[model samples]
Target: MPLLFLRRCGWLGLLACLLTACGSHQKAPPAFTASGYVADRGAMRLWRKDDVAQQTVNIVSVYSPYKGENTVITRYQFIRDDVRQINRTQNGEHPETLQIRFDDKGNPSFMQRQRDGLREKLSDDELALYQFEARRLLDVSQSLRAGQVILMQGRWRNGVMTTCDGNEVDPDFDRRSASWVAARTQRSTGQLGVAWLEAPEGTQLLLVANEDFCHWQPKKSEL
Candidate 1:
């Protein structure tokens, strides 16, 4: 009976050692999600939901050519409930997915705009103010874990059109922009020829998008 007891004790000891070894091999999570934004090479720009306008934000700027006397009006408006991409560098690197619940408020910190091949960060003074407001609105007193990585990525079907100031291209129809687009248009031809709705000439176009595409509308001020 003593020998049997000793054998049982030996088995228990072995099991404990195995468990300890396994625990030692396990990996702790890479970083806390509350750490804010995850830097990625592929995505140069990162935007947080908090930066989105709670009501509406508008800015009008002027664009001038280096030599020509021509000038263009640039208007940017941000508004509420507008969901835009928060991660993207456009640096030609593979995009890493952090399986995250995007709806969760206040983590990424601020909206970042990258330009000059990701060499420069464009500043949005208003967005900074909005970031402050977002923090004030969110209760981030509790800590949170980083998002999980999605092993299998999602796929999408889309229409593409590319053009320059003097050039034009056409694309197929997509309903995202309007109820008519996805339904009426089968195929498209000119980039400048995109579906158009007439309104007063002076208008502010609000855009929300990632690298995929832009959804724009004339601000209520213009309407």
Candidate 2:
């Protein structure tokens, strides 16, 4: 009986050690990530930062229309999968800004909108729509991440490209695409900004313009 008890104790100790080893090998999720998708008439870029300790998430999305000059940027703040606040800004001929905050019970605590230099009130339907969109975008971000789609932005100068974070990268551009980017860069008076999407399948160029996109990009600390 004594020997059997000792063996049982030994087995329990081994099981605990094995569990501890597995826990030690487990990897923590990344704190920051980015993803994007092609919208109906344009493209949208998303950046997300997670506060694991606080159980919160912050996401920023930029939508640029293909034919229109308008650019829409939205920020969503979430507390454990529940949206806490949303801020949106549209820039173009008719600029607008909208802000909404929700209480602990998910009720709207504050809502405001300003368009064309005039302050306006948001209707209940509009508020609901914004909340729905926020949830939809969160789902979209999760899908993109699961599919391993990544968004990258950089500056192109004299045939060399430096990423927004200042890392040099050689994008997988074919001959025709490379030539076109080079031509555009040469024709532009200022440094050319480039944004692209990368996945296991291939790389797709999203935008190339004279304006610097890094200027307004959110950093990890800001998120």
Candidate with top TM-score is 2
Q: Which residue ranges in model 1 land beyond 4 Å of their true spot?
A: 1-103, 106-112, 122-195, 198-223
After aligning candidate 2 to the native by TM-score, how far in Å is the CA of 100 from where it should be? Answer: 0.2
> What's the lDDT for residue 66 in model 1?
25
- Model 2: per-residue Cα lDDT over 51-75, one tens digit each: 8899998999999887778999999
Tell me the whole-model lDDT of each prediction, alpha carbons only: 0.26, 0.77
- The estimated TM-scores of all candidates read 0.18, 0.82
Stretches of candidate 2 exceeding 4 Å from the true structure? 1-29, 174-176
State the displacement of the C-alpha of residue 147, model 1, in Å, after optimal TM-score superposition. 40
Tens-place lDDT per residue, model 1, 1-223, is: 1111112323334233334333333344331111111111111111112223255323322222223333323233334532221222222232221111123353333344444434333345644454443332121111111121111111112443332122333322233444434332344322222321111111111111221222321223441
